[model samples]
Target: MNKLTLFIIALLLSPVAVAATPIEQRMADYNPDGNLTFDAKRGEALWHQQRMVDGKQRDCNTCHGKDLTQAGKHVKTGKVIEPMAYSANKERFTKLKKVKKWFKRNCKWTYGRECTTQEKGDLLKYLSQY
Candidate 1:
């Protein structure tokens, strides 16, 4: 093989190329052990948990819907959200920017506060499973 071809192959096979995903990078703070230790069950529960917001109940399911594989509509804007599950959607948690953006926006909207590192980690863990 040519030098350039070999270099490209080596780069592709390097540890950096096979390193943790964007979600994993975000979860690193909560998962210091470098392992996926977050509880998916807890994440699932948190998604369904209803919180009283301004005398109204709100949750991730409020817009994302109960089924992760199906598209959901925004309660207020009526905007359609793409399916979150990797099974149903080819792209999910593939971009760090989008992931951070949505978590920040959605967490504040649902819980009235910024989510903790653990909360974000758990949520990503739960969503990635599907």
Candidate 2:
């Protein structure tokens, strides 16, 4: 094989060389303790689990909807939320800072506290599947 042909082959395989998604890379940053394990099933359960918010029961599904691929609306504000599934919305989990910002805001709003690292990892893992 000529040098140019080998370069083309390497370029074609470059995507495979890049293993982790941006979300996964962010998760790794959060897991400095090196013991965290993410579970999508747990994340799904968390997404559906309800808690009292301003005397009303709510969960992530209240705003994100049961279908991650479909758009959802805020129960009170009525603001449209883009689809949560990465497949449906390519921008869903692309940025580390934005992901953390939403997690901080949403977890407090939905569960009355920030999510633990495991929870965040699991949620990202679950959403990335779609």
Candidate 3:
């Protein structure tokens, strides 16, 4: 076999590795004994922070309202959404996958960029505390 052929075989058999920062490695880390409670304060602050989007500045509260406790309805469809009260929506949040999806969407909407895992974790922690 030629050297190129051996190289190709090695590449196929080698493990795929991606580098991640320590914070990223630990962002998903949770303390089993530590409290996973919510802290609405941080979520509230993140929700209102203005960031650049499409070269324009915006924030989540621009559409979602500063106080998330009130029920919001789809302006056109009139579909209502519950307040982001943690206890009221505990079941929906038991799965981390669901939480990540929303974080990606909401982060882009509010910050115009995907939030770091730490930011997502912190936001989720704060929300859970509520």
Candidate 4:
């Protein structure tokens, strides 16, 4: 009816507004009280943070490597992992289920505990930078 209403309608139909990546959508959902600001640095730090488990230090990078753009190998299984960056790998973050599956498996293996929603959001933020 009004110019403001028309603008809102246009924005709502816009691709950028409608096409939120699965990861982006998840991070937004993870936000607590709309106050969460996903920090890439914090994510990166968690990526590299070492935790000694069973006399061995492990981190996200232990299997994923430091470069999200490069393929990494699983330390234990010797399976090759795909690049994690959305820019580098188009399939990445395309599906929320896969992301959740890995987060659950990896967090347990590396951190020995399930990651918190904040941690998951932070890690997504970090990977987004690549």
Per-model lDDT = 0.80, 0.85, 0.58, 0.84
Off by over 4 Å in 3: 1-43, 52-57, 74-78
Q: Model 2 lDDT vs. the true structure?
A: 0.85
Candidate 3 lowest-lDDT run of ten: 18-27
* lDDT winner: 2
Q: What lDDT tens digits, residue by residue, belong to model 2 across residues 1-130?
A: 9999999999999988877777667777778787988888988888888998568889998998878899999888999999998778877677778988999999999888999988998888788786
Candidate 1 vs candidate 3: the lDDT winner is 1
Compose the digit string of candidate 3's lDDT tens values, residues 1-130.
Answer: 9999999988876644444333223234533444444344765677668887567667755554445555555433767766554545544455556666777787876776898654666665555555
TM-score of the candidate numbered 1?
Answer: 0.75
Q: What are the RMSD figures for all models against the true structure?
A: 4.6, 2.9, 13.8, 3.0
lDDT of candidate 2 at residue 3, scale 0 to 100: 100
TM-score for each of the candidates: 0.75, 0.82, 0.53, 0.81
Candidate 2 minimal-lDDT segment of 10 residues: 21-30
- Model 4 residue runs over 4 Å out of place are 1-13
Lowest summed lDDT across 10 adjacent residues in model 1 is found at 21-30
Clashing pairs in 1: none
Off by over 4 Å in 1: 1-36
> What lDDT is obtained when candidate 1 is compared to the true structure?
0.80
Q: Clash number for every model?
A: 0, 0, 5, 0
Candidate 4: how large is its RMSD?
3.0
